[model samples]
Target: MNLTTFLVYCVIVTFTPGPTNIVILSSVQHSSMRQAMNYVLGATMAFGLLLGASAILNRMLAGILPSILSTMQIVGCLYMLYLAYQIFRMGSAESLEQHPSGFASGLLMQFVNPKVILFTLTVIPSYVLPYYSSPLILMVFVIIITVIGFLAFATWLIFGSVFRSFLLNHQRAANTIMALFLVYSAVMVSGLL
Candidate 1:
């Protein structure tokens, strides 16, 4: 396996604007940095599980259960729309409190996240290990990707957290920005479906 190729994949996947990052950014803007960090942890855990499962089962499953992929895509797209709505409806940052349940909610959200699952099932297998077949090597690759993803997502959350004070000062403008993000997410999801 080429380390450079894996690193490139990690950079691309982690840096892209996706549902996980969107949620983290919204949460940080509305609540606290600590809550956003919890979300990062939850999302990282979920990504790890998906990566591992795809590494172990993607080949057999792809051949036998093609419908499963379609189902996942639909579920993921719908969930993203729901998340967008939730963000669009939220009140100003000061009125919103950090919820303890956000950690679990963040983790579960990744399960239905089409992009994450697709990357795990396709990109990891195809680009990361085009010729390699060793399970240990694949597992190591998955772990590396997961770590990179965690760091990248955390960076976005931190950006939101650090700028939250500025957002709080201009409540209406901040809400408008978030509402636009919701619309953007919805449009992206519709394109996917």
Candidate 2:
């Protein structure tokens, strides 16, 4: 509830690089800022939904469907590996002829992301617990976290958008970066398993 603690939580959740950010950055390399913004919006909505769901179902989920969480994590890890393969195998834009919209992809990706669930289940609740007795207070905490998440993600998307041209110009280097990111994602996903 304290400002210091809230800020610390935000920093940890928003600033650390994760699969979502990596994917957004990759999208930016092939799409426009507008598309990236779409991804951000979808991602932000997912965060809010997760936060609200955690508020309502934390106890029930923990007690009845704990294995479900583990299954989600494994599935998410496999998906990340799949994404890595996609990135590495991607053909040039001229060959592909169409760029997928980042927004739609971003929105859908959040549904399967294990990190988002982990964050909602773990970090988000801590910020809300102090205000548990009051509905208004809890809502306020969720709103604050949601807003901060949106802003932080927007910043990253904008950064990637602005630099997308540079990435496109250097296709080889960009692919190399993508490969590295895929490896990083795989390692992170493995930790969950």
Candidate 3:
């Protein structure tokens, strides 16, 4: 088991920009830290669950993951569009109110995120299975990967927090930019891009 290689894979893939991280950053910039934290928790927990499922189901899921992922991608695309609309609407409102994304929405987003699902499906086979065969060791790997995932998300939140004040002052511009990002993410997720 090359712990270094496995950890490196986890860091690179989990930390890369994706729907969950984008949403988290937008949520923190436009909403609040507490809301962002809830989102982070939801995304991270669902991601962890997906990792475990992928690891255990392994070959079983490989045959089916494509179809499931397609469905999820469609759902994810629609949801991302909706989120974009929501962000645009929030900015358009005469009085900007914090309509932070909730836990359930966050959780659902993760389930539908192709990036997460595919990452899990591949990671288990490439990193965990070869290195650790026992169920116990696999579970430990899952836990470790999940923590890494959480930390990756936290980094986005921290980054968004850094821009909160600027976003507040430039609400309309910020919202527009963020909403466009969501829209782009939707297109990418749906394979239009």
- Most TM-score-accurate candidate: 3
What is the RMSD of candidate 3? Answer: 8.7
lDDT of 2 at 132: 57
Better of 1 and 3 by lDDT: 3
List model 2 lDDT by residue over 1-193, tens digit each: 3456456545445533456765666666677778878888988888888877776664345447655444544544465455556556655443323335566677777778776766666543344442353556656767887888787787667776544455457757665666556455444434432
lDDT of each: 0.63, 0.60, 0.69
The residue-by-residue lDDT of candidate 3 on 77-98, one tens digit each, is 6766765676666532224344
What RMSD does each model have against the real structure? 7.8, 7.9, 8.7
Query: Candidate 2, which ten residues in sequence have the lowest lDDT sum?
Result: 90-99
In model 1, the runs with Cα more than 4 Å from the true position are 59-101, 161-193
Q: Write the per-residue lDDT of candidate 1 for residues 153-182, one digit (tens) a residue.
A: 888787766545655576566545554554
| Candidate number with the higher TM-score (2 or 3) | 3
Which residue pairs collide in model 3, if any?
A: none
Worst 10 residues of 1 by lDDT: 184-193
Where model 2 places Cα greater than 4 Å from the true spot, the runs are 59-101, 161-193
